[model samples]
Target: MSLASREALASARERLDALADNTAVDAAKLAEELAAVTALLDREVSLRRVLTDPAQSGEAKAELARRLLAGQVGEECVELVGGMVRSRWSRSRDLVDAIEELASGADLIAAERAGDLDDVEDEVFRFGRIVASNPELRAALADKVADRRAKAELVRELLGGRANPVTERLVLRLVTAPRGRSLDGGLNALSKLAADRRNRMVAEVTSAVPLSDQQKQRLGEALATLYGRRVHLNLDVDPEIIGGIQVRIGDEVINGTIADRLAEASRRMAG
Candidate 1:
């Protein structure tokens, strides 16, 4: 997204932040609204892609967006989408993220009110870092550097042992998310959203191999104790990590892997 578009999205996010107050929103009603917004954004994004493709003319794309959203979208949604189209923000990732924020904010509020949504939000952030840290894996997921099925397979073969059930499912879902824009864009939005759902942040831990069930339970308990609050640990597995564990929570990283130690040694020697 362009800088201008990013600024606009920031503006939109500020507008939506007001709804985050749990007291202001009706949990049940807002959940329904959130669902509606998600569906609307999905359809809008789909229409935007179909319309904005270089293969399709602008007029053709406009007409299509109109037809698809005209009856299906609510009055406010229609106006919001139409404004985006007019502003040429239909293809902007910033705007898409803005829409996602509005929807996710509503979900978070509803979940808070219901008191059932666990700390999945942190897990999502950790998942993003896991993907971003691995060049080959990140390329495969975000850039189609590998075949789709290969990407899916890599998730099973490499990540099977490393990540938690939720993390594994999240990766697979991102790899297979139906494309309106790039799958990465949609998946990234959703992942960040999952993080925003929790009260406490997520810490994603990577291991060379799968941790045993006993280890997982112990590790979770240990982490919760350390943080003085419950924390969700999403597991990630990569053979290249090469022994030990790498735990990442936001910008903080604890790399205990042999590979990392070697890299650190090399850096120190060079300096």
Candidate 2:
């Protein structure tokens, strides 16, 4: 995103925060509505371009958004979308991306308010790992030619009662309407968004064995101290690592597994 788009998105997030702070507002419904708006804008390129057009007055674009969304969505959603159009976006697609982000953020906020955010975050990461391991399932969800309804049903069947409602909804939306994102990419994006809800960083921790609660706590604390932010662990088990753990925070990796050590030693000998 350009600076303008980033600023616009930041302002929109603040607006979402205000809405979330209101006990009367339904964050889930807000999420659904924003997703709908995002889908609409993504499909209607000309309209999005017009809404983000610099020549048009901000009020005009805002009014147009309000008029288009008035009866179809709630007042809060209409106002939110209206405010978004009233702001300058670097590109029309940036507008859609910001709204999509807001949709995910709204779902995270819903989970947070319901005290299920931690579970949702963990569920998202675990689901991504599951998809990574299951080629058939990943293909099913990633199939663009597949019927949307079928994919939606598969998502619901997999997540319905087994996961938090917010998690189910977020996954269902991404799987059903990927918007050209690969399955893993979409899932990772959702996981990151979930972490950002609390201003935390996610550390992907892979180990030969599951870490105990104390171990997880200490590792999280150490990473937090290192990164200067709260860290959430996305734990994975892989016996192939043989011992110790591998921690991935974004592009950086802290490798301590026996497999990694052996590989390095073999490379040194080969050299």
RMSD, every candidate, angstroms:
9.0, 0.9
State which candidate has the highest TM-score: 2
Candidate 1 residue spans exceeding 4 A from truth: 22-24, 27-97, 122-188, 196-203, 208-233, 236-243, 248-254, 262-271
Off by over 4 Å in 2: none
Q: Candidate 2, residues 1-271: lDDT per residue as tens digits?
A: 9999999999999999999899899999999999999999999999999999999999999999988999999999999999999999999999999999999999999999989999999999999988999999999999999999999999999998999999999999899888888989999999999888999998999999999999999999999999999999999999999999999988899999999999999999999
Provide the lowest-lDDT 10-residue window in model 2. Answer: 172-181
| Residue pairs with backbone overlap in model 2 | none
Clashes of each: 6, 0
Pairs that collide, model 1? 121-194, 121-195, 122-202, 162-236, 162-237, 163-235
